[model samples]
Target: MTDPLLTTAELTAFLARDFEQVKDDFTVDEITAQGIKLRLNVAERHLRPGGTVSGPAMFGLADVGAYLAILSRIGLEALTVTTNCSIDFMRKPIAGKDVICDVRLLKLGRQLAVCDALVFSDGDDRPVARASLTYSIPPK
Candidate 1:
C-alpha cells in the first residue's frame, strides 16, 4: 500500500491552523496502515463534577481522532466535515490521566470517509468509550 499523504507533523500543524480550539489539547501519537492514534490531554476543563472526563471531552477526542485518521490518508482537506457520529460512553475515564483514541478507517471513498474509534483512559487496556463517525470529503 502507498504511504499516507500527511505526516504527523503536517497533520499537527493543520490542526493548529484550522482547528485552533483543539490543537493544544490533542496530539497525534501514531499512524499506520490500519489507523491512527490520538491523545487528548485531559485538563481541568475536561473534567465533570465528579472528577471524571466529561462526555463532550470524550466525544471531541473521538471526533478529532477520526477526522485526523481520514486526513492521514487524504491530506489536509480542511473542508472534510463530519456528517454523522454515534458514540457510547461505556465507563468513566480515569481521573488525572489523559485519554487516547485509536481510530480505524472503515471506508474511504470518493465523497465520504467512515471511521471507528475507541477511547481509553491512558494506561488502561479497556476502552471507556467507542465511536463511529462519517465525514463528508470535499470535492477537489
Candidate 2:
C-alpha cells in the first residue's frame, strides 16, 4: 500500500488555516490505508427541535470526512470538490453526543475519488447514517 500523502497533523493544520468555519467542529481521529476517521463535536446548533442531531449536520460530517480522506492520499487539493453524494439516514442520532465518521476510499483515480462514510453517535455501536460521495480531483 502507498503511504499517505498527508499526516493527521498536517491535515488538521490545513483545515484550521483554510476551513476555519468547520475547523473547530472536526477532529482527525485516525488515518489508515483505506481512509480516515473524523469526529464532529455536537453543539446546540447541530440539534433539531426533537432533541436529535439534524440530518444536515451528519451530512456535513460525512462530506468533510470523505474530503479529508481523499486529501490524505492526493495532498492539499483545495479545489477538489464533491461531484455527487448520496446519504442514508439510518437512525436518529443522539442529540448531545458527538458524531464519528469512518470514511473508506473505494477508488482513487486521476480525475475522481469515490468514498463512503459511516457516521455514528459517539459511544453508540450502531451507525446513524451512511454516505457515498464522489469528488472531482483538480487537474495538475
Candidate 3:
C-alpha cells in the first residue's frame, strides 16, 4: 500500500483547515506509515470520579484519530463523518496523562473508510482501549 501523509506538520495543517477541534483538543504528535499518534489534553470534564479518563474523552480521541488517519491518506475531505463506533475499555486510563491513540485505516474505498484505534495513556505502550470506527465519505 502507498504511504499516507506522515508528518505532524501535515496532519496539523489538514486539521486546521478542516477539523477545528483538533486545534482545541488534540495535538498531532506523530504520523507514520503504520499509523498516527494523537494526544488529548485530559481535563476535568474528561475525568471520572476515580481519576480515570472518562469514556467520552477516550471516545473522542479514538474518533478523531480514525478521522485523521483517513484524511492522512486521502487528503482533506471534510465531509467524512463517523457513521459508527464500537469501543472497548480495556483498562482504566491514568487521569492526568495525555491520552494517545494509534490508529490505522483498515479499509479505504470510494465512499467509506474503516479504521481502528489502540488507545493508551502517555508513557504507556499497552492499550487502555480499542475502538473500531466507520466513516462516510461524501461523494467527490
Per-model TM values vs. the true structure? 0.96, 0.96, 0.89
Per-residue CA lDDT of model 3 for 11-79, tens digit only, reads 787777776755768898877676677888787778989899999989999998998888788777878
lDDT winner = 2
Clashing pairs in 1: none
Better of 1 and 2 by lDDT: 2
Clashing pairs in 2: none
Lowest summed lDDT over 10 consecutive residues: which window, candidate 2?
1-10
lDDT of 1 at 33: 85
Candidate 3 displacement at residue 49 in angstroms: 1.5
Instruction: Summing lDDT over every window of 10 consecutive residues in candidate 3, give the lowest-scoring window.
Output: 1-10
Per-residue error (Å), model 1, residue 75:
1.0
Q: Model 2, stretches more than 4 Å misplaced?
A: none
- Compared with the true structure, all predictions reach lDDT values of 0.91, 0.93, 0.85
- Winner of 2 and 3 under TM-score: 2
